[model samples]
Target chain A: MNPLRIAPTDETPTVNFIPDEGKFEISGNSYPENSTKFYSPVLDWLRRFCAEAKNQKITLDFNFDYFNTSSAKYILEILRILQDCQKNGNECLVRWHYLEEDTDMQEAGEDYRDSIDLNFEFVVREDTL
Target chain B: MTDKQLLYAYNGEMSNPVLNKILSTIQTKLSALGEKRNVVKNVNTILIECCQNLIYHAKDKDTLKEDFFPSVSIYKDAGGYRISTRNVVAGEDAQKLEAYLAKLNAFSPEELKNFYKERLTDGKISAKGGGGLGLLNMIRASKDGKLVYRFDPVNEQYLMFTLSFLM
Candidate 1:
């Protein structure tokens, strides 16, 4: 399958899903004009990736500076997809990165961690991204 | 009078690009004023939800009179940053929003957090795809988990809904 690469926009995040390297990274801001329109294709790509990359070690990295409520829903959706894949024997780990002083982002990471059954590692960055 | 500074204000049609410009401008302004990084992030997060809520839920701008164009303003005073928005909404929409806000305002922070997670994981996304998380997020991000709002009857068919947040 082809790698899924979406350039970051002022309203959306950078999506870099590399199957060969078993690394999936989504970073930057994500308050798209239309959350569904922006995330549907990305969700589709992830479904396909999970189906094809079974029994593999996957690392998902999420580094978001800001995301709106709508984008928050999509983030949970993305995590649910990963959780399902993990249930199917894929070794999945999530690295949630937030700015050091951003308690909201840190709590957001904690929210996702509490709601999902995946191994989560929180990393704090010293400077703004 | 308290020392109050007006940071940004907009009134008119709202689009994605317009929202981006407003957020970027406010982000820079807040940071330049010596706000901590966390404060800036929280302010921007609340502003995003507020502006997008206006953009997505307000009735079509082309159909509304100029006086009814959605408006948002950010202000800073001794307490903290404050954001307020006003937009014309259908009467039925106003009722639904009022009830939702009342329910949310009644929740403690812990209860609100649990409700947010439950809705996020289980609630169906709205046709517009936000899944009704806008007000909940605003309440969560507000300084004291409170939202002040009112719906003044614009006419029999519509209402001028106003919401304010302090962070």
Candidate 2:
């Protein structure tokens, strides 16, 4: 399958899902007017990728500066899909990035980590990006 | 008089474009204030969630009643920034929101975190795809982990809902 690359907007995130490399990254702010509409296709792509790439190792990175609650729900949905992939015998690792001083984002990462059973790493950087 | 300065306020339509404009304007204002990066980010996140609640849940969009105007205001207090939003909601929604806020306010910080995780795992997403996380996010981002709210009845069918968050 082809990689899914979406440019970032003022109210959305940049999505780069590389099937060949088995690396996926979503970064930037995400608070789309209609989050479900914006995230449906991305979720569909993940579903397809997980189904087709059996036994492949997947690394997913979520680096968000800020995202609203609706975006948070969709993000959980995406992580759950990846968790299922891991449960299906594929290797999956998730790296959640946040600013070093932004404890809210860090706590958000911890929340997701607590909710989802996967190999999750919390990466903190100084820069907001 | 209080030292709180009203940095920005908007009273008009709560459409997507208007919300975006409000967000950018507030972002610029926060940048000019020279606050810490984390402070600015927290204020921005809280402001976005507050305005979005108005956009998605405010009633009488088509009628555009004068009394039903959705409004948002940001004030810089000695402690920090205070963001507030007022919008008209259906009577039922007002009641539901009041109960939810009461329950949320009752939780301690640790309990709130635990509740947030529980909701994330079990909460049902509405038809509009809102999994009822906005209020929780606001509380989580607030300095006191509390949201000050008021509900005033406008009429039999509508109520004015006000929410304030200090960041």
Candidate 3:
């Protein structure tokens, strides 16, 4: 399958999903003007990826500086897709990265972790942006 | 300079570019002053949600009279940072917003968090692409769950809406 690579913009996040390597990462800020239009394709690609790749090891990293509420919904949807992938026998691990001093981002990670059934590793580090 | 400092202010169209510029300007100023990381993030978050709400819900500039231009500003006072927005909305929308804010103001912090997650997962996103989460997020970030807002009659069909809260 073809990889999905979307470069980050001033108002959106980077999305790099490589099926061959089983590594996906979405990092940076996400507050696009049209969140639905921006996230529709990413959700489609994820569904297709989850269906095709069975019993594989997958790693998804989410490192967000800031995301609006609309983007927050889409992020939850992304995690839900990964939850389905885990249910299909894939060993799925989500690395939730946040700035060491950003309690908002850290709490956001915890909220996403509480909703979905996945192995979530909350990693705190210095700012990388 | 006065203790009540006007850090950043915008008065005009609530376009995406303007919103980004506002956020960027505030981010730079706050970072330069070594503001607390979380406070800066919260301030930006509040600004985005507020401005986006204006972009989606406010009446078209062409339709409104000259004095009703949508505006947003960030300033610092004795209480800390404050973000405020002024916009014009239809009477019906104004009513709905008032009731919604009243309902949100009644929730405890834990209740608000639970409600936010519930809406995030299950609520329908509006035609304008909002899940009706903007005010919720603002109140979530506002100091002590206080979201001060008011509406004044602009005309027979529209109302002037003003919303502000502390960081």
Q: Candidate 3 at A74: error in angstroms?
A: 0.6
Q: Which residue pairs of candidate 2 clash?
A: none
Greater lDDT among 2 and 3 belongs to 3
Q: Rank the candidates by DockQ, best first.
A: 1, 3, 2
lDDT by residue (tens digit), candidate 3, B1-167: 44878898888878789988888888899998888777778788788899998888767656556678888988898888888899988888888889988999999999999999999888367777776788899989888797999999877878889999888
lDDT, candidate 2, A13-113, per-residue tens = 99999998889999998988688888999999999998888888999999998898888888999999999998888999999998889888998888888
Candidate 1 regions with alpha-carbon error over 4 angstroms:
none
- Taken in order, the candidates have interface RMSDs of 1.3, 1.6, 1.3
Residue-level lDDT of model 1, residues A1-129, one tens digit each, is 999999998889999999988899999999887889989999999999888777899999999988888788889989999999999899999999988778889998999999999999999887934
lDDT of 3: 0.87
Candidate 1 lDDT by residue in tens digits, B103-158: 99999999999998888888477777666788888888788889999989877788
DockQ, 0 to 1 scale, candidate 3: 0.70
Q: lDDT (CA) for every model shown?
A: 0.88, 0.85, 0.87
Candidate 2 residue A33 Cα shift, in angstroms, is 1.8
Calculate DockQ per candidate and list them. Answer: 0.73, 0.65, 0.70
